[model samples]
Structures are given as C-alpha cells and as structure tokens.
Target: MAVVEGLLLQATSTGLLLGALVLLLVYYLSSSFSFKEEDNEPPGPKPLPLLGNLLQLDLKQPHESLCELAKTYGSVFKVYFGPKKVVVLAGYKTVKQALVNHAEEFGEREIGKLFKNLSEEHGILFSNGENWREMRRFALTNLRDFGMGKRGSEEKIVEEIQYIVEEFGKFEGKAFDTTQPVNNAVSNIISSIVYGSRFEYSDPQFKEMVNRANENVRIGGSAPIRLYNVFPWIGPFLKSKRKLERNTEKNRKEINGIISSLQETLHPDDRRGFIDSFLVRKQSDEKSGQKNSRFNDKNLLSTVLNLFVAGTDTTGTTLRWGLLLMAKNPHIQDRVHEEIDRVIGGRQVVVEDRKNLPYTDAVIHEIQRCANIVPMSLPHVTSCDVHFNGFFIKKGTTVYPLLTSVLRDESEWESPQTFNPDHFLDKQGRFAKKDAFMPFSAGRRVCLGESLARMELFLFFTSLLQHFRFTPPPGVSKDQLDLTPVSGITLNPSPHKLCAVKRS
Candidate 1:
C-alpha cells in the first residue's frame, strides 16, 4: 500500500510541473501580444491576410490614393503594399518633421525588388550606409568640379539653348510633339557634364540612348512594374519587367563602350568630366592596393547610370511641364514673357538675372510646385526603430515621404489646387520663398543635383520663352489642353503637340 502511494505522489508531482510550465508559457505569450497592442502603432486600413492593402491602393496613382487616405487616418499612418508595411508621412509639417527633424531615422533608401534587381544597391540612388555616403560625396564633388551649378555650367546650358532654339526653328511654327527635342536638349546638358561633350541631336547612338532611358523611366512606374515590385516572383511573367531588363542590359553595354573609350583616353591631369574623374580615382585606388574600394568598376557603372538617368529625367520632365503649363495658361505665359522681355530684353537670360526677374522666378517656382513630378519622391526606410508623432515604427519599415501632399498641402498654400504664381509672391510682389516648396524633396536624401536643376530650369525656361511662344495646336483651345499627367517614374504630360511659334 505504501509503494502504491509513492507512485501516485510521483505522478502528481510530474503533472503539477507540466501544468505550471503551461501557465508560464501562456502568460509570456499574452504579455508579448499585449505589449504589441500597447505600442500605439500608426492607424491604417484593415489589411487582408497575405494581400495586405493591395486592393486598397491604386497601382497607377498610389500617391493620389494615399492622399485620400490621409483624410481619414491623420498625417502619420501605415499602409501595406503586399506583406510589406510602410509608414507614410503626409502634409508639409509631417513630412518636413520626419525628413528634416528625424532624418536619420527616416533617411535610408527603401530598395524595392525592382530597384534591387536593377541596382543591386550599388549606386547612390538605391544604396544605403557607407556605400551610399561615399558615392554621393564623390558624385557631388565631381559634378561640381565639372561646373554643375557654376558659370561653367551656365555657359554649357547657354550653348545648348542655341541648339534647342535652332531645333525648334526647324519646326517652323508647325505643331509638333516637343517630347523628343526637349528630351534631347535637356539630356545633352547632362551629357556635357558627364561625358564632357554634347552629342549632336542627329547622332543615332545618342538618340537611341536618350530614347531608351526615357522609356525605362516611363515604364518603371507602370501597373505591371508596381505589381512586380510587390510580387517579384511574377517578374518573369511580366512583359514590363522583361522589357526593363532588356533595356537595362543594352544601356549597360552602351555605357560600358563609352566608359571604355573614356578609360583608354583618360588623362589624370586633364580629367575631362565625371567619368574621367571616377576612372582616375579608380586607378589611384588600384595602385594603392586598396581593398574593397567603392570606386570599383561596378560602382562606377552604376553611379554613372544613376546620374545619367536622374539628371536627365527629372529636369527634362519639369521643363516639359513648364512648357505645357505655359501653353495651358496663356495669361501666365504672357506674364512670363513680359517679365523676360522686360527684365533682360533680347540679351541671353543668365543665372545672374534670376534675382531681377521675380515674376518669372515666381512662375518657375509655381511650375515646380504644381508640376509635382516626383510625387512620391523616392521610398525611404527607417534606419532604426522610431517613435514618431505618437506612433512606433520598427526598424527597417519602408517610409514614403508624400511629396504630393506637401506640395499640395492645404495649410501651406493659399491656392493649393490651382496654378497660382502669387503663391510664391508676397503682397509686395517680390519673389518670396515658401518652406513647403520641396519639388526636389527634403533632408538627407534630397536631390543631389538640386542646384544644377535650378540653373537648368531657369535658363532653359527663360531662353525657350524668349525664342518661341508655346501654344496648343490649331483648333485646340487652352481649355481643351489637358493637364492630366501620364503615369511614370516622373509625371509626364500626356501625348500632345504644341506650336513653338518664334517670337516676333
């Protein structure tokens, strides 16, 4: 009987231990889940399993959809693109705070699958941490050295403007799509800075390169490409993805050819342009036996590619928008024309003349604000876990600084929805600066070529206005001109023709 009692006691002890362990596990898990609930994560639309908020977003105009969501869920909110969670900072105040105030926390570039496949995080645009820092520094320094924003650059642009004027004269006031010529002209400016020389517009190779680059930009933001970003495995099935890959490969080969020619003729003392400067640095790094230098051939190729594409697309698109806007609002165009004719007369419009042309300057600023080309800016990732605006965002969460919201912020602009130059003009009618004018974006990841772009826009716009009057084709009223932008990596004007009538 005693032996039987002992066995029962042992069994009882084992059962109690097992029960205690189960209770402890339950408490720990419950506490963990409760802790997450108390984290005060940003509010967002309810996400479906696996799909997340894919159905909620408009793939074509995701920025527009997010702006609408901001109406219901405040400035700081979360949304899911598939299983990926993203925190969006909307409005001028919120965006500025997150980007400028909390820059480090919200500064890292979020490399989507498409970008990852294209860039492999090698270049300045899609890279992070040490590699990005080194490349950006080098690019900025080299670009400035090659007269990116200086008088040298001004001279290059002035020369290019004459070419553009000559090209427009070829149209002889006939209605023609300005896309190719405008893209070519703007591209040559960067080409001059990158390759140290401009290509003739008639050059087949040059035209092909420019056309391919622009096409990539157009297709990069297509619905299929957006889906590819969310579901990378579907890339092989998507035509857009395959086309992008093909275009990228061809461009890579062409770029390699150009770089090889530049490499063979590289003169250390007479570094011609950005490519020469990079090659010289690469050679120096090699001679020093530097291990893992960021100046490798891959970095050089990717960086050049990044600079070429970025330098061409945004400035070119903005210039196109300016012309289209001028065509759409002839009154605004007239004022701009009057300003240019009044301030600088028939003489060349130089960078130094910007201050004297406040009305014209205001118009340009307003163009950028209204154009809102890079509506989403580039996606940013959190460098670390962040508690921002009463919300907890974990480390590595993708963040979209909604530039569209800031550019169109109701609180910031007096007429946010309209094209109003007075938005940048004070009661005194002088050119005034608004803190919310962030067409190039803000903070650490702000555009590297901002100064260069500013110079380009002013010179290009003023010069074009001086030479020709932009108008919609015959029988197309100003009202009939559509402002609807074609979806792209940059918002582009839809297929339209305008007459660049030579000013009498």
Candidate 2:
C-alpha cells in the first residue's frame, strides 16, 4: 500500500511539473511572437499564444463569430490561425476591394495537402497556374458551346424541371422526404452536361457516390478536419479523418468506373459527353505538341467529380431550406403559389417565368442571401506579397473572405438577421440587385457553375412551390421550422421533417 501511494504521488508530481512547463512555454511564445496590432491590419478578436484566436472561434457557425469580430476590428482585419497570418475581408466594400478590384493579385487558390491530393492540381477548382488557365478556358468554352448561358440551356433545364416535378408528383398525396429527389434532379442536370445522360435514382453507384459526397461535405469544418490542416501528422490518428479519405477514394473510384465505361463505348468520332470532347482535344493537343496538356482523362474525371460534390448538396440543401422557410412563413408560400397560378395558369413554368414573377424571384434571392451556403469561400492564396487597406498580406498567405457577412451586413440590409425577401425588391416591386449580395462569391475564383446553379435554383424552387404547399407535420407549430445549420465545410440545415401538402 505504501509503494502504490508513492508511485501515485510521483505521477501526480510529474503531471504538475509538466503543466507548469507548458504554461511557461506558452507565455514565452506569446510574448516573443509579434502580431502587429496596428490600424492597417484587418480587425479581429485578441489572439493568444500559439493557439491565436482559435479558442474564441466558433468552428460550427464561423460567420456569426466573424461578424462579431468585424464589429470590433472593422470590415477588414488580420487574424492568425496559429503562426500563419490570415487576412479576413468582411462586409461588402472590403470584400469588393480585395476580391474584385485587386482580383489579379489574389487570383491564386490555396493548395493544401488535402485539396491537392483530392484534385491533383488538375481540376479547375483547386488547380492554379498553367493548368488552371488551360482547364478554365476549356471548361468555359465547352460549357458555352454546349449551351450553358444561352436559351438552349434553358430548354434543357426546363426539361429536367419537368422530370423533377413529375417525380415529386408521385408522392402526390404522401409525405415523403424530397432531399433525394431534389438531389437527383440537380445531379441529373449537371450529369446531362458532363456525361450526356443521367443515372437512375436507384443506381447503386450513383447512390454510393451521393452518400460519399455528403459524408465528405459533412466532415468539412469539423474539429478533426481543422486539426488535421493545423497539424497534418495528427491526421492518421483520427479514424474519422481516415474514413473520410477512404470514402472519398471509394466515391472517386465509382465515378471513374462510369468514365471508363464511357471511354470504352464512345469512339473518337462520337463527341457525346464532356469526356468525349476532352479526348478529342487531347488528340489534337498531342498532334500539336502542346506543352503540358491538361485535357487528359485524370483532369476530366476530377472536374466531373468536383462538379458532383459542389452541385449536389448545395442545391438540395437550398431546396430543403426553401421548403422549410415556406412552411414557417405560410404567407410567403401562398404568395408564391398565387403568383404561379396567376402567371402559369396550368401551363409549364420555365426559367423565363422568373422575370414575370417578381415576388417569387425576390424570395429565391432572399433565400440564397439568407442561407449563404459557402459563407467563406474555399480559401484563396496571395499570389505575391501585396499590401491593401493597411496590411501586408504576405505571399502564399490564405485569405478567407467572410462572404455571408457581406450579404447580411446590417449596414446594408434593413433586417439583416431576418428572412426578408424585400431586401431584393425595390419600391416598384421589381427585382433589385444588391451590391452586398454575393452568395456565390465574386471575381475570377467565383463558383464555376454559378450560372447553372442560379438557373437550377430558380427552376426547382418555382416548380416545387407551384405544385405543393410545404408544411411541418401535424401538431408542429410554424416556429418549429428548423433554421439551425449543421456546421460543415458547407452550412447545412439541421435534419427536420416537412410535409408537402398538395395545392389542390
């Protein structure tokens, strides 16, 4: 008994000593490392030691915290994520100046190990330099050539919308979760562009890919993901992190399998899917001896995969929010239904219908503005050392602009925190564009699928609202409309149940 007590005492003594040493070390580091608290640097909360302002940060809802910090630090300020300096641009004007006015200086994308590993510096989203330019050009050209922005694109979108409405109608009088069907509709639209066809909702591979994509997205902004980014060596120890990577690999394999099958069946002459067009470009480039051709199969696969990831959850989640918002504010839902009835009159509503439906358009814009999915865009890198608005953002530093803050800036909006569609409407009841509104971000690094995404949201929202009125389950009050977003790389609403009551 004496021996055991002696061992316990020694262990306790060692722990206390170690704790004291850590405290002393931290104090020393905090004092030694100089973070200039000058007027020039962007504003933020007081940072401490090696942890910086990490403890004060709310990883789940970073936008709210950023807005609070912006209040003290001003619209623009600097904060450190450990030893690294990150310049955060808050509010509309600051964001505009940094991302738009100084676009060239900040055009570089941040290439961390994980993003590079996933994209291999091949796809447009994470790739930079020569590869990015080449791929971006190709993607834009093909997207345009295949009718992305033109009326032809609208026809395709309307066709998909029709199919989606029909699918939703199957749940005619039943209360079914619309997430999968909405996701399928959005994915099919993009798939039509990429693969020239859409997969069945029941396809095992398609379902698996969607599941994996959802998992990866959900893991984003999680403590483990942030931890891994901060200390890469710790990644292997976290099983969830490993699971995320494994799942990503599995998803990639499934997507690649589809691409491989297409390659086998489609001859060089047949320019059907995006891959076919890419293969043709590859052959031409090979003949011309183009330097570092980026149109190869690997890039094609990664680009399509990126599309699947970016397109699926965002649109589906937005629809989910739309339904919830309508349910919570039945007045808004009735207004939408009235507009559809008055405008369409039992006829098909197309993308062109938005121009005629001011109330509906305002509501859709409000939803995007309020929800603000990708609040802080994928971090951008400083191409070279540059000084703007007082601070020197060093070369290779990551710049995370709180985009949602800009959208919801109280200085700009009347009811910044509330769901007011009037923010996008003028006194004339016409749609008015707000300079502060940038849900899809701005400048060169903005969402590549911005046009398509906008079209999809408009078509889906209008189509669904025209058919059915959304409501919470019986006995549930309107206040129960879940607005709590799940903290991930993308801000998703918490799981909630909704019933799509038929308009008739």
Evaluate all candidate structures by whole-model CA lDDT and list the values in order: 0.86, 0.76
Q: What CA root-mean-square deviation does each model show from the true structure?
A: 12.6, 5.6
- What is the Å distance of residue 225 in model 1 from its true position? 1.3
TM-scores for all candidates: the values are 0.92, 0.90
Q: List model 1 lDDT by residue over 188-207, tens digit each.
A: 88888888899999999888
Local accuracy of candidate 2 as per-residue lDDT tens digits, 1-504:
344323323333233223333543645664766565544455566777555766566655766777788878877777766555677888888888888999988889887666676678888878898888888778878876666656756777788777777777777556667667777877777777777777787887787778788778887566556645654544444555777788878977887887778778878766666766877787788899998777787888778777788878787777777877888899988888888899987777777788899999999989988787788888899898788887767778788888988888888999998999899899998989888888888888888778888888888898888778788877789987679888777878777767776677
Error of 1 at 215 (Å): 1.2
Worst 10 residues of 2 by lDDT: 8-17
Error of 1 at 200 (Å): 0.5
lDDT of 2: 0.76
Which model scores highest in lDDT? 1
